[model samples]
Target: MTVRTLFDRCRAFQARMPLAGFFSHSTAAVLHGLSLPKALEGDSRVHVSVVAPTRAPRGEGVVGHRVDARPSVVLVADLQVANPVAAWCQTTA
Candidate 1:
């Protein structure tokens, strides 16, 4: 599937989620149009960062991070995605 298709799928996945969090990691990279490594290409898990007190959303295909500071974010196709810089930082750590 193409990036557009992946974004649509992410949007759909976000819609079904109850907790509020911005997409991070490879998911955010895709939203920001950043090229990803081959290993990440097959990662269907959605990466998200939630507020520290609230637990990260859990499920079969989701990777959640608990952060004390909420990172900046932007909406892509109506899905909340972490900003490129913050997402890049997240990916680095």
Candidate 2:
């Protein structure tokens, strides 16, 4: 999917989750202005993180994680996402 399509779809999905959702992993990396390897730039799923003790969201083109997200998630183009450090750490796991 196009970058715009991915971003738009993510934002739409985020709106439906509790308190919106925090983008994580590669998705957060992009929001934080980090460059991903060329091969991974076009991943289909939009990575998002939700609170622990909850099931990861499931659907087409979305990958979810359970984590202790910070209260200071940044907003990029109206998409809520984890901070750079948290995002980078998530990607490492």
Report the number of the highest-TM-score candidate. Answer: 1
Give a tens-digit lDDT track for model 1, residues 1-93.
Answer: 467876776776786664768888888987788877777778777787888898887777778888888878798878888888887776666
Worst 10 residues of 1 by lDDT: 11-20
- Candidate 2 lDDT over residue span 1-93, tens digit each: 466776777778876665646788888877676777666777767887788766677777778787764545887887887888877766666
The alpha-carbon lDDT assigned to residue 62 of candidate 2 equals 78
Off by over 4 Å in 2: 37-39, 69-71
After best superposition, candidate 1 residue 8: deviation in angstroms? Answer: 2.9
Off by over 4 Å in 1: none
C-alpha lDDT (0 to 100) for residue 81 of candidate 1: 87
TM-score of each: 0.82, 0.77
- Please tell me which predicted candidate would have the highest lDDT against the true structure: 1
lDDT of each: 0.78, 0.74
Model 1, position 78, has a per-residue lDDT of 81
- As for candidate 1, its clashing pairs are none
Candidate 1 versus truth, CA RMSD in Å, comes to: 1.9
Give candidate 1's TM-score.
0.82
Note the clash tally of each candidate. 0, 0
